[model samples]
Target: MNKTFKIYAVIFIIIMVILALFEVNKKEVTDWRKNFDVNQKSPFGLFVFNKEAKDLFKNNLTKIDVAPYDYYTDKNKKPHNILILESEIDPESWNKILDEVSKGSDAMIIANRLPKNISDTIGFYGSKISYENENVLKLTDKKYQNDFIKLDKFPSGRGFSYIKPNVQILGKTVEENNEDQANFIKAPFGKGKIYVHCEPLFLTNYYLLQSGNVKYAQSVFSYLSDRETLWFVESNTKESSSLLRFILSNPALKYAWWVFLGGLVLFIFFNVKRKQRIVPIIEPLKNTSADFVKSIGNLYLQEGDFHDMMAKKAQYFLNKVRLDLLIDTQNLDEEFAKRLQLKTGKSAEMVNEAIVLIKKAQDPYASVMKEDLARINSLLDEILK
Candidate 1:
């Protein structure tokens, strides 16, 4: 390799090495995605909640992957209190769930937002709220009114925008300047009750790890009936979907993935440049025909052969007209000038002057001057220009 190539290779290797070292020693960032998966130990995952779920339900916790419609329709399974922690349920499944709820099976849904069908059915609609500073959250009951839990800064959750008279407010989070917004509610269907809690983030591993937050979570669970707690697990597993997904979900692995891609690109670039055969520089072939013509033209100009040059120019012009205009050049008459004028879009006078010069040059005894030659050349140029 040349010195320049060697220098570039060394710089590239140094850059790659520095990047690798930096990435390897970099502090791992916290994953804050609200995956809400029981298996995920991320900040917004339900790993901690799922871990302590057995104890909370007295070892009677059961996870169901099937839809509420299919699960409820099963003849073998009896009515059990359901627990759902997801973004939203399908409308069909939700309707079936409501039917099960009406059949005296209690359910507690924890999500950021309720589906439009659910919201319309319950006669309440909620909006998302993000607090930049700490806020107070408490149950609406007289017993827990004074038990205010401090929500951390930059906490985002959902709250009711409109609540009907029948929907009983269970709990609320109050921001510094705003009124208490209902985040929890108890809506009756028939004989059973569906407790809708908007803030699923409050029950995640991050909040559960905090002091007094587990107690708050426990308090929220206190409203549920003490029966076989059926935890509804959605069929679509997001985190464990693929290896690439798992890598991207993790901060350290994501950084390593990008580093691997960078290294691969560098390796391809350097390896291809080193191993690939050098392309030979082939110069373009010189145009000798045009050069020969230019040499002959200069020789003629130096020889003072104005008559010969004029004859050659007129003959060349007539030959070009025969090939380009596809007109016969045997007769240089009035009709010929008119036809030439029409074909070349030149004035009739100009065409006639060119023909006259061409006819004069063709005569064996006619003498050609420099100005006459130049005049014919200019007339031909004007016609073909």
Candidate 2:
């Protein structure tokens, strides 16, 4: 083929390939198999019920986003029927529902497992299970002999139960061996009955939209007993739709927010560094008095003038005695030592030793040995204490 012809053929092949992929991928992108929730408008949600939702309520059903216990009040005069879709019910909520149901109210509980009280009361044991597509759930009632409620060829998740006595079995799964698995029950309490269906997801938007399944879902509602009020309860939490959250969800808006946040981070980074205080470095002060005194003491030690130094020390001790004791130091006798002992609270022997040392230190011609100097220092310490 020529170059231009070959290019044209390749372009045509690519366009055909793109068209084929679009046709095939569209179903997967729009899949609604496992989406299950009450408040959602998606395929798993009860958007199909919206048309007949308000009709079920006498006061026009306002869709509740909170739990049934939170949304319903004790004083509510309306006889409401609750549709509970949960795996388990806590004590408080379960007791409240039981109490409400006893007081002329109805509740349709849909779960694989029931609360212990309800299970005990109903006389049945239910367990969650998975089944192959070949297995089918069959419905049978005394009112109808037809097996019209045959549910198969769909995914079965978390909805399987075993049969027991006392409770009326509304439906059962048909096993491969033709043994029936009781999955739906109705039990009467005080003034009302609790209709429990193990297969809750069958009432979802995806199942209802399927061929002939809407009829089955409507048949399930027939068990509600045509109550005055309708309540849809699920475990999904409610989040109020906000414009900011909506904007943040979108890629463009989220990117813009991130860009603004990045700018704010940069501004903070630069400002933190720029606004920091410049710390001044300060040098510590050096003590010079101790050094000066040490130099003078060394000079005195270098000289052979012990008598003069000893005399100066004795004069200093006398001055300290006069200042601290308020005693006259005019005489250096035993009378002076006795007076000093009373004034200073020192022992009489210690006072006499100090006086003798002071008197010996007063002589300028006396040679002072190192032991004598040490004795004088020890005597001064005792007098000071």
Candidate 3:
């Protein structure tokens, strides 16, 4: 049943994806973006542009997706062209764009934001966004000065002012205010001219589907020559080592990457290195005196040091006699032997015999016999008792 459910889920997902691929929203509104992704149908997305921008030029038309620096290096002279950058371009790319433009080529940069260098190069200013409502662009074109080119369903334009005299304000977006600030600008810099549009949402699918909006887009393109290459500078074209971008570029692989990352973190967290119980420190049993004496006896027997062992035992016995009985053990004489006999209450003959055996064992070359050692132990035990 589980396998069958998984199979059904896979089939359902496939069907949903296929439906989404072919689906079109005919009456949907309010989806807007200043982005140029063709997959999106947002106000500033390139879905409409990708479909219609090629139609703007039929003869000698070339559309390339290359950076400004690459374009500058490859092409000998920049042509009368239209460049649409949908995001904030870096200084290097902006400089390259200016360099190409100043060499007699015309460019229309459609962006909501510009790099500071370019903004300073062109006098740009902004007022507080007082209008939250959708807006339409009012064209104040130099070519068509008397006529008004106004269209609706465009995203609300920002209120901004610009330096004039040398700068030509070509278009203004009408919002809640009576007169919107200049959102479209045409200016001359160095050897050529540049046209900048602040409201890029006009080129999106949101308004292009509106009546006469596609024609309005064409009219905007009319400012540039139809003979040159159209470079569509995509968003985030700057050098960004963005993992999010990689995941976004591969929809199917995004889930796989997330799973792998989560699994790895869990493996590190739960499967902690190696969980062995703290093995108790079982210290070996401490050596007792009996064991120590036994060890020493074994060593003596092994090395044939029986005479040394016997002398140590006799010296220990004499020390006990002097300490316990208060008897003089300085000399093993007849007087000492008589005193030991009285203290032990053993016979005088037995005491004298034990003294002789101990003296014989004390000699370094004396052969130690077990029976003789036993007799000495008996006498020492009697003295101890």
Q: Score candidate 2 by lDDT.
A: 0.65
TM-score of every model versus the real structure: 0.61, 0.52, 0.56
lDDT of 1 by residue, 1-385 (tens): 6786777677767876887798788787778787788887888888898789888777888987777777766554556788888745777788887887888888898877777868878778757675647776788888766555676734664688888899999999888777778988998888888898887777788888887776677778888887888888864343357899889967768877886787678768876877859799999999999999999989988999888889998999999999989888999887888888888888888888888899888887898888998999888878876
On residues 269-384, what C-alpha lDDT tens digit does candidate 2 reach at each position?
65576566888989887778989989987887899566666667778889988898887899987778888888888888888887877888886666788677778877887788
Q: Rate the local accuracy (lDDT) of all candidates.
A: 0.80, 0.65, 0.68
lDDT of 3 by residue, 183-211 (tens): 77788877777888877776777667767
Question: Any runs in candidate 3 off by more than 4 Å, and if so which?
Answer: 1-44, 47-84, 115-117, 123-132, 140-154, 175-177, 227-234, 237-306, 313-357, 364-385
Reference-based lDDT, residue 126, model 1: 56
Backbone clash tally for model 1?
0
The per-residue C-alpha lDDT of model 3 at residue 356 equals 88
Once fitted onto the true fold, the runs of candidate 1 whose alpha carbons sit more than 4 angstroms away are 1-16, 73-76, 128-132, 235-238, 241-243, 249-253, 265-385
Q: Please identify which of the two predictions, 1 or 3, would achieve the higher lDDT against the true structure.
A: 1
**Residue 355 CA error for candidate 2 (Å)?**
54
Model 1 TM-score?
0.61
**Number of the top lDDT candidate:** 1
